[model samples]
Target: MSHIFPRHSAQSYPVAVGGEGCYLIDDTGKRYLDGSGGAAVSCLGHGDPDVTEAIKAQLDQLAFAHTGFFTSAPAEALADLLVEHAPDGLDRVYLVSGGSEAAEAAIKLARQYWVEKGAPSRSRLIARRQSYHGNTIGALSAGGNEWRRAQFGPLLLNVSHIAPCYEYRLREAGESAEAYGLRAANALEEEILRLGPDTVMAFMAEPVVGATAGAVTAAPGYFKRIREICDTYGVLLILDEVMCGMGRTGSLFACEQDGVAPDIVCIAKGLGAGYQPIGAMLCTAQIYDVIAAGSGFFQHGHTYLGHPAAAAGGLAVVSAILQRGLLPRVQEKGDALHARLMEQFKQHPNIGDIRGRGLFRGIEIVEDRESKAPFDPSRRIAANIKKAAFEAGLICYPMSGTIDGKHGDHVLLAPPFIISDDQLDELTDKLSQALNAVI
Candidate 1:
């Protein structure tokens, strides 16, 4: 009956009519709490006046500018602000419309940087398993989610997938977290050597694995070892922070907590919150210098790159995050949320694990807690849980194929940084109801 094309045609969809704070209102007036920040996008929650005002002001002043010949003030200012707050050596920003675009740009930039640097043989990419980069072609190829990549295998370029630093499932019995981290990181080295390091252009991963692995954080020292491996092999480190960055992880940049910075980093979602769709691929000065000194052009372009209004929204959103002191608040709320989850679900039959940092957390479901055995894929536990959550006026991210391409389930929760204590309790209560219904 609707002219609009939906994501899943077989399933009816809710028309989100309005949003305020951490709740999204449907046409029927059901207010669903944004438990996962709508795939971890809405950092400041919905309808923040500051961000909307910035967008309106930018549209009134300069609505459109073709970046092929011109650069706008908002774009420049946004880039400057991002670089100012970015990890050391990450000195440039490439603005795009969303997460996929950012990932695509990062991939191309990494390859192009090598080409310009006279290392054109560096064409292969290495990423960790159970990671989700973006949906675009290049990004998809770089991502290691087998389920997402299966149908597109023929079209996808070859990429090496090393074992992810997922400690809960991957760590051996009696292994310390720190030791397990180093072992997990060494997988990259093994793959790089197997493929020949010079043939590899970049090693991409999320600081905290999102969507596919359900907010899995790396073991301690995992990324530090990863950084060292990249440096050793002359490979570029590309951190995909699409879902976990922008104060979602109690830090402006998720990599900040890891105490390491990547050569190129992709960020989106929370950057513009839900105010505007904007994402950026940030790189070090060295990478930028190599291309600038060689070709003077990066040889990549998107018509919507650096659109003024989007940049304005991103600028305003980030400004509010910093100026209003939301970073520390995320940390506080995150700790509270984590503690509450542990208190409530530590002994839950279906709740196997509760893990993550800041407001981003994951509750892995299991058939047996002692075995960490996942519910059968045919059971569709994740899908049913989602339906139950939605019906109960809760909006959380529940995903299948959490352990591999088809074995596990997890509910990822990343609420707005501004969520209050009462809202959080509501989230937990609703989630419990959903679990009770399905699990």
Candidate 2:
């Protein structure tokens, strides 16, 4: 038996030996197209020379520097780059090792900001049902995915979950999409009133729900209403862009498309583009000023918070994204991918819905398209599709419990920004074969 523990203990996985562009090669020389970018992390594909050289250079200068003692050049530069393109009012950055840490920091920063402002009662956090932030205890508490939080319930903090702005499922019959968005966004106001707005510290959500719900986009005007409500109630709006941010959605930040900015935002995945493990939590100048003026410290950190090498990787990855002009390409290519998917799956009985933005897209699997009814959980549709896809030389992200914690199934496709027209067809073909194999 292998000494290393895997994600799934019961199953043995292929040993991936190398990655070239958008494909991963196994030890046996089998190549698998990176359709989902390994949970949407590798936005630059793989084996990027620029990113590698940057990492190597940084390793020579400084690999790691304890943030408690000294800060590194790469870390500082990375922060500057992030703020340059950050949403309005967000001017500070807190570096972390990965998405979970960034999320944990965002939550703690929200609480501490309130404490600094002398509102000790602002302890409750409000999020959306069917949303996912991270897997760490504090972050998990804020996420509304019942399945991810079930076993850890006893340890999670109290969090109020409001309905998500999911139009396909929650929009009532005969309701306009815009009207449904407003109604869904209003749920936050109701929750705040019930919890006494003063007691709620922050409202956390993803601009585009990932992983658990696939690439579920919000209805029009949803986030604008959400931002207005947060401002009125003095609640900090925290946007978790761990998967949807950093040019994945054709914009540097996914909230840019929503036309609303958050008080705090967490981002990862595409930051280092899988060249290095990294994430960051960004906040407004006002929040930083309050903490700086009062305690002079935010009071939360990890040992690897700002490792130089990781920051170098992130810096290069972002620079490549901006300098090479990948954002607009993402838009053009994404539209092409969506068009191809619609053309291919328009009549697929099991392909219930094809929706998403830019390179990040999702296809909901269902049993009844007219009713939008999902496949039964017992069918293990998502799992079966994932296995079939992998076996057919593709790597796609598919998950169950898309509707709630157990009702729906979806396949999330987030290819690298460098994916080509031919590659898009290859992705759809492989996905279709997988779906056919399973359904």
Candidate 3:
């Protein structure tokens, strides 16, 4: 009877009528624990009064403003706050509506930066296989998730894809983790050389691979080597933190733990914490200065760029993250959650790996733990797990085609920063039940 088009036309969905903290209530009053934070978007959890009030106040003062003619106070303030806490050398913020737009802007900016520097041929982009950037044309071209790109292959750009820093699948039997990490990162250098370094503009990747790869963190020393390669080849290192940044991975920025800063970083999801649709693309002042000194125009824009109300909500969410001492809590609680997962699934036959940082964690489902073999794609393991978990009144992110975009599955858990110990227990119990029923 609904006129709206649904994400899955064949499936009817429960109406989310209300939410409180870590739980969402349906019209029939079924409460689902928000274990995955609704695709890791609701970091502060649902119905936070502070974020709501900020948006409301902004709407009262000024609901919207076009960035062409003017910039709003909220937008300026939000950008300032983001840059204040961002990684070293990243001094500029370009606000957008969400993750896709942020990534689209980052790609265009990277291309523009090279052009302004008089290197117009530096238009190629290299990203990791099994990685996801976003869904727009440029962003999708940069992503290496084959499933998402299969139907749109002809429309995608000619972006190169290197091997991912996936230790579990790619590491040799006797290689040390550190050695494997270095080897994984060196793939970027090889690809850049093969393609001619002069033609490479940027290398894009998620600090902690999300969605397609299920919170896959890079091996130790991996990002450091990547930074070195990009530096040597004059290729800009662009880290897409759209799903893993904004304190989702224990740090304010996910790359902070990796001990390297990127030339440009994109963030969303947790920025406005689902209170408002907002995202930002931040870059080094050096890059900004290049365009500033040249054309003084980036030649890119969106209607909702630097939207006032969204900016206000993002400012409040980020302020709460810093002011209310939630970063440390995310770490502390993340450790606790990881420990519980390990203890619960240690002897389980099908659970292959438990990995990730902060509240972002992934449980890789395998046919056999000894061989680390994935379930057959025809089994639809991830899809069934998602269905079972939803029926069990728990919301989690389980994605199929995790390995090479075809033959693996993983369940990603990204609970809210405010999830209580009791709620953690409930989440684990529900997830366990779902796994048992499906696996």
Tens digit per residue, CA lDDT, model 1, 1-439: 9998888889999888999989899999889899999999988888898899999999999988989989999999999999999999999999999999999999999999999989899999999889999988899998888999999999997888988888889999999999999999999999999999889999999999899988899999999999999999999999999999999998899999999989999999999897888999999999999988998998888899999999999999999999999999999999999988998899999898999999999999999999999999999999999999999999999999999878999999999999999998999998999999897
How does residue 23 of candidate 3 score in lDDT? Answer: 97
TM-score of each: 0.99, 0.99, 0.99
Cα lDDT, all candidates: 0.93, 0.94, 0.95
RMSD of each candidate relative to the true structure: 0.8, 0.7, 0.6
Put down candidate 3 lDDT per residue, 254-287, tens digits, no spaces. 9999999999999999998999999999999999
Better of 1 and 3 by lDDT: 3
* lDDT by residue (tens digit), candidate 2, 1-439: 7998789998899999999999999999999999999999999999999999999998988888799999889999999999999889999999998999999999999999999999999999999999999999998998989999998999999999999888888899999999999999999999999999889999999999999888889999999999999999999999999999999999999999999989999999999999999999999999999999999998998989989999999999999999999999999999999999999998988788888999999999999998889988999999999999999999999999999998999999999999999999999999999999888
Worst 10 residues of 3 by lDDT: 338-347
